[model samples]
Target chain A: MGRKQVWEQGEVLASAMRLFRRRGYLGASLRDLEEATGMHPGSLYRAFSSKEGLFSAALDDYNERVVEGRVRAHLRDAEDPVAGIRSFFTSAFDTGGGPEPDPGCLLTNTAVESFSVPHVAPGVRRGLETIESGFADALTRAQAQRLLPEELDVEKSAAQLLALYQGLLVLVRSGTDAAKLHTITDGALALIRARNATAKQADEEEQR
Target chain B: MGRKQVWEQGEVLASAMRLFRRRGYLGASLRDLEEATGMHPGSLYRAFSSKEGLFSAALDDYNERVVEGRVRAHLRDAEDPVAGIRSFFTSAFDTGGGPEPDPGCLLTNTAVESFSVPHVAPGVRRGLETIESGFADALTRAQAQRLLPEELDVEKSAAQLLALYQGLLVLVRSGTDAAKLHTITDGALALIRARNATAKQADEEEQR
Candidate 1:
């Protein structure tokens, strides 16, 4: 209602997201939300239609502020697809490498918590699928330009990249050394690179 | 606590594990715990101590029964380390894969929750780390036996495996297709195998 109330509402949602990311939808509560956001039940309810509503806002914030802006940008920023993927992963590891790491990605977190309740599961589902599609589309374009392997299944390859990102984030959050993550990603990206190069050789030979 | 109450404790904890695994700690409530486990707060507390106490027990149950007993057994039952890792991944996917999936690993879910709250954080940390260590150790030994490969860092390699498992389970819970999960796992595992073989071959040739 008041200006402070609006700011508090945003603050409440942020706290809720952090708590939700830390615990999950079923694990968090109105009380926890209140404590974190500094809002009482009536105020919390007035701002958020329900607990689920708060969670939905938190997830939206996570995707918009972090996943699209950070993760995807990290992937696409390199001069090429291969370099882009590598940069994305390096950032993924280093970003979480500090003493404090936000558990890899909140999007990955959403994939886990959206199932047991009728809350914002769809939003999370779409978020996961949407990112995978973006990467897949990139890979497809790369393949057409001979940047990726012809053998790469557009959707499956996308999922593999998505899986790698998701899995690597978990490791980072779990406090793995950056060197180890580098090795893991190096090995993975190498495989993708090899596949791409091999496909190119075959295509060149066929054209000749 | 009465004998009947003590007897019900295990069931209550079991219910908690299933619910916690499915919904995570913050998402599920005392009322949800009561409804799921069919116990009153007084009785539940009398048996387990508190909500955090109950969670601690549930995590233990997950280790002893779900992970150690079931997952480990399946891994060992496989013909080789490659298959063993596959078994572990498949099991993670099995629980997570379906038309509707449960998105959380009980241990990963605990880690997410415990990070924000210091209350039961220690136990949560210990349990999840134990599982990660278990998978890595098993994979390392498999590599030592030449079932995995020489280039793979046992710790790093194992983290990769665990990361993929956690990632896929999260996606599955987020409404990822069961079939696509199969693709992600297959692609990931193949690269792991390829890395191992290529590194081993190079090392073997160097020995010659």
Candidate 2:
């Protein structure tokens, strides 16, 4: 076997993340990790010293490269920044694959479970901030190009989007049907677009 | 203990709920419950039987009392249904104590951590459904009073409110300060009101 096949660090972390997403920190055990990742306990520990350590590393990797990437990748390929934002919400909230929605963003799951738990809180906070920054960055670029209105509060709006994303995750987890998510995400993005248009009109009127 | 105190079988459940709120189910333990509630393991088992049973009871109580009561209480007192919703979102997102806001809403935390877990999913669903029904009931009442336009979709709007509320909880958990939440909440409510006004105006215009 090739060295890459022997050392499946990314693959192992992904499996652990799925478990963490389903069962939280205390909910998940080392044995669960072993079962999910197909690694012996010794092999898992050699890769990640403790369960907490493994979770943290998985979160960092997922946030930077996977979850944030999902949003960033959407923004990168879209011709219209507005369309990008719109599509981002759709993909994030709309449960496409099944009758019942899957659990929401794993990062969100970790954040909710990490509140007073010190071992996991920092990692969760860091991942969320990174995701927030990514949204703000995209928004900033969109505004500079005159796609988004001048008076739009990107930071607050970004915060709102993050909240919106988190809330949708809760909805999906609670077994809210895909149709419910579709409407909610639609209403949110509609408000976003309408508000920007209204702000721009107000600015133009002020200039006149 | 006073005679009234003798009937407080639910106090231990309250303590357990607080612990579950502060720390997730897997994070909170029988030992933790013993320390927090000052009940011996035998007394606790006599009262609740198992950790899962205690959680089930505590969650049921919270949904019926705290989460549902908060929303129904808002609707009960407001002059306008929209105003009532604004107040509901404000209070639901606010954690009562904490120097920096420790991610409020027990229902939300439970939704995130327990929805996919085998035992707690039903309770979490019940909590969300109760909250959603709060909005639906309020909107339906308003429609009966001719406050919302006839063409307005009450079921859809309630679903949106549910989505928004859940999303806001995620926002609260993700460390959104009140100021940020207020901004988003205001934007959302204003849009709802503006849309209603627009639809009414369109009806008047069409009649002319």
Candidate 3:
């Protein structure tokens, strides 16, 4: 055998992530992976073992780079926890005015595509949990600050927010225009605010 | 060539829809389609042209039967429009208490799987539009009857409801328990009711 060639794992993973997102897990072919990563079939196997192995690594990369990084930045940099939640919804549409070639979340995509490949389903589940927990933490903070309805079930609300977020991503991927998505996200924020407003009204009524 | 065999298009579409729902568009194979529909490869080709062709037919069937049928029934059978909207959401989780082998919406599945296959994306869009319009009609009626907030933008609220409903479906498909899905759905309905309650409090305050 010739001298074993070494490759940058991150570079391979980045390319794999893009390929998997664009073509999906089952739709992506070995030739597509080879071309995207500039690795021959033998090198691809030597480095990643199998397509599924490569997919798992790519999913990890997506979780860290896309989901985790975005969640932390949005939550940390916001004016407050409520604003942070609103910011989270708005930022999904800030993809710069360029035409979006691929617009869906890879984790959401994997959730739909994970039926056949059961091993990857757990990764999607974890990605979903990360999002749910992020929303849960924010909602909890909002409640403590009296910015959210005291009666809000943080766990259930967080799960609902996660689902709405995932659904918005699905609509975005399904070719809904940015303007319409912005309206939907705005409506969501209004609903959240209305919950708090209604609680305040109830308090005022009791005092009266 | 032997005489073309007559095949029931409805049966083929139903079988293809099930296979596509269980295994995603990309994950479902020609062999799986053949096995599900009980048709040989040549007959399958003769009937539907190609895999994409069959997927298109299956998508049409899903739109007609699952999506439109459910929306119409929920809206018509309810006591009123607002009740119709609530009914629309409540009906999604009524799976008769059996083990839910498939817990997600087929159109939502197609939406995620529509990235590479641009042709099928329109069908997902139509499904979403039908849902949004259904919610909008109900909300409009609710506003006229003073059951919803006057300032509510029916269009945006409808889209938001669509996203929430779609999100709920995604959660269901992701192995969330049926009871949990029910709670999440209940939370959504409460949010909708709270919108009007807050408005009622504001009116009472004005009167006071």
The best candidate in terms of lDDT: 3
Ten contiguous residues with the weakest lDDT in model 1 chain A: A199-208
Each model's RMSD to truth, in Å? 6.6, 6.0, 5.6
lDDT (CA) per prediction:
0.64, 0.68, 0.74
Rate residue A134 of model 1 by lDDT. Answer: 64
For candidate 3, what is the lDDT? Answer: 0.74
Give me the displacement of residue B156 in model 3, in angstroms.
Answer: 1.1
lDDT accuracy of residue B23 in candidate 3: 84
**True contact recovery of candidate 3:** 0.53
Q: Model 1, B145-189: lDDT tens per residue?
A: 887556765665555566666676666666777777766666545
Candidate 1 deviant stretches above 4 angstroms: A1-51, A96-104, A115-117, A141-148, A177-179, A190-208, B1-9, B95-104, B116-149, B196-208
lDDT of 3 by residue, B1-208 (tens): 9776577889988988888887888778899888899889988887788888889888888888888887777653445776676557657766667685663677888888786567888788888888888777777777878977777656667777888788777776777777666555554554555553233433442231
Report clash pairs, candidate 3. none
Tens-digit lDDT string for candidate 1 (A91-200): 76665446655644667666655555566777776677667776765676677679765876566667777777776766565556676676656644644543422324
- What shift in Å separates residue A200 of candidate 1 from its native position after superposition? 17
Clashes of each: 13, 2, 0
Q: What TM-score against the true fold does each predicted structure earn?
A: 0.75, 0.81, 0.87
Q: Point to the candidate with the largest TM-score.
A: 3
lDDT: worst 10-residue window of model 1 chain B: B199-208
**Candidate maximizing DockQ:** 3
Higher lDDT: candidate 2 or 3?
3
Compute the interface RMSD for each candidate structure: 7.0, 6.5, 6.5
